[model samples]
Target: MKNLLSLLTIAFLSTGVFAQTTWKADKAHSQVSFGITHMTISEVEGLFNEFDATIEASEEDFSDAKYTVEIEVPSIDTGVEMRDNHLRNADFFDAEKYPKMTFVSTSSEKVGEGKYKVTGDLTFHGVTRPVTLDVWHRGTVKDQKGNLISGFAISGEVKRSDFNLGPDFPEAVLSDKVVIDVDAEFKKA
Candidate 1:
């Protein structure tokens, strides 16, 4: 009886140490987008039509969460086909040379209720740079299909010159700062 009790205790403790939840981005409900100043007169927005994101967490509040995202460089769309094509060319992203942009979180710290500061390495245009982004947990819910879903909003900024993107264009032509916004829904996996 003592041996059986010891074995049960170990099993319970092991589960706590090894258990983690994985969440996959629901593509139908998620968006990866960005905005940048155009000619220093107005802002132009664009989005990547194809991307993948995943999160792994052990804590319920996601204080120990890790995130990863990959975006197809050629999938950029800016409502104007000409501009989109330009963005994918050598003058901008050079999609033929760098086909994928990715990000991986290095640390996450909870700042307030449902809010966190996530620092990660963002790789774009063949350049990798560390960036810090603000993240908001919109909450979690169960869908009619009995699947658990969680929503998150992420916002940050990156400099065009940092990655040598559109190097030929001056700040007046294409603002150096590019703003990023992501709204994503993850289904428990």
Candidate 2:
């Protein structure tokens, strides 16, 4: 009986030591933005006003972190009402049919000091494709309220054609490549 109790105690302590920590994005401090070339002349920038992201990690350096993100398609804003509406129509996102874009990380590899290469499956416009994004772990700190917070700057590029986004549009009208940039802060939860 004493041996069984010892084993149980050891198992409980091991589980605690290996427990994963979860962090949720602090909405007010996070932004999901994208940029695309327009008319082969200038870049048009936009952002999704509503998004949720979470990270799970067991290491302090976040080398083993898993990330998941969901963005509302109808929340896209380009600072122009007409353009935003157009983007939501069938010519572009078709937000009525597909209202959300999501990404679930399959792997995260630490390549340098505070730098990571994250690969994931991204689902948008009713299509799922593999994508790799560069991440800069901007470190973590304790807030004034004693809450732990971490910051990340993530960037990636995706071909709109791959996701059937604006299928009829030519590269001349709008660049096929779109750049995604996210500046996010996560509070430990």
Candidate 3:
């Protein structure tokens, strides 16, 4: 019984030691931007300035990664303050009603050495949809603070009408498709 107890303690300690790797978003260094067609001739670009992500993976690979992302829709900037304000209103994001958007990963599949196909449920404007993001793992390294960091870039497109985005603009000027791009940096948590 003494030998068994000792072995169990050693196993528990080893598990804790091996679970040291963790990654968290460096919000100041991350960005989430989106673009969509405007009048079929110009593209309107906007970015959400406040967002964060959490990541946990083993040193061996990102296959075991778990990710959760949250974004503040009211913090969107389109370079034009007027347009940005309108976007935050009821016609678009309705920031007052749905102040935030989020994505929680459901599954991830490795398609290449540093590339993955991630499927998650994206909640926006009081609606949720299953979206797939093409994710590229840029790599991992140590930051100036001596913390481990991981970088990733993801891009995907979703239909605005599917989320009840607009009611005034004509289909010609406002395409249903919106392209989203994310450049995220994660640090050791």
RMSD (Å) of each candidate, 1 decimal: 1.5, 1.6, 2.3
| Tens-digit lDDT string for candidate 3 (54-145) | 87676446876767889999999999999999999998899999999999988889999988888899998999989998999999898777
Q: Highest TM-score, which number?
A: 1
- What is the descending TM-score order? 1, 2, 3
Runs in model 3 with CA error above 4 Å? 1-21
Worst 10 residues of 2 by lDDT: 11-20
Per-residue CA lDDT of model 1 for 48-138, tens digit only, reads 9999999999887888999999999999999999999999999999999999999999999999999999999999898999999999999
Model 1's TM-score against the true structure = 0.95
State the local distance difference test value for candidate 2: 0.97
For model 1 the local lDDT of residue 150 reads 95
**Model 2, position 20: C-alpha lDDT score:** 92
By lDDT rank, best first, the candidates go: 2, 1, 3
Q: Each model's TM-score?
A: 0.95, 0.94, 0.89
Highest lDDT among the candidates is held by which one?
A: 2
As a whole number from 0 to 100, the lDDT of residue 176 in candidate 2 is 97
Tell me which residue pairs clash in candidate 2.
Answer: none
Please tell me which model should have the higher TM-score, number 2 or number 3.
2
Which should have the higher lDDT, number 1 or number 2? Answer: 2
Whole-model lDDT per candidate? 0.96, 0.97, 0.87
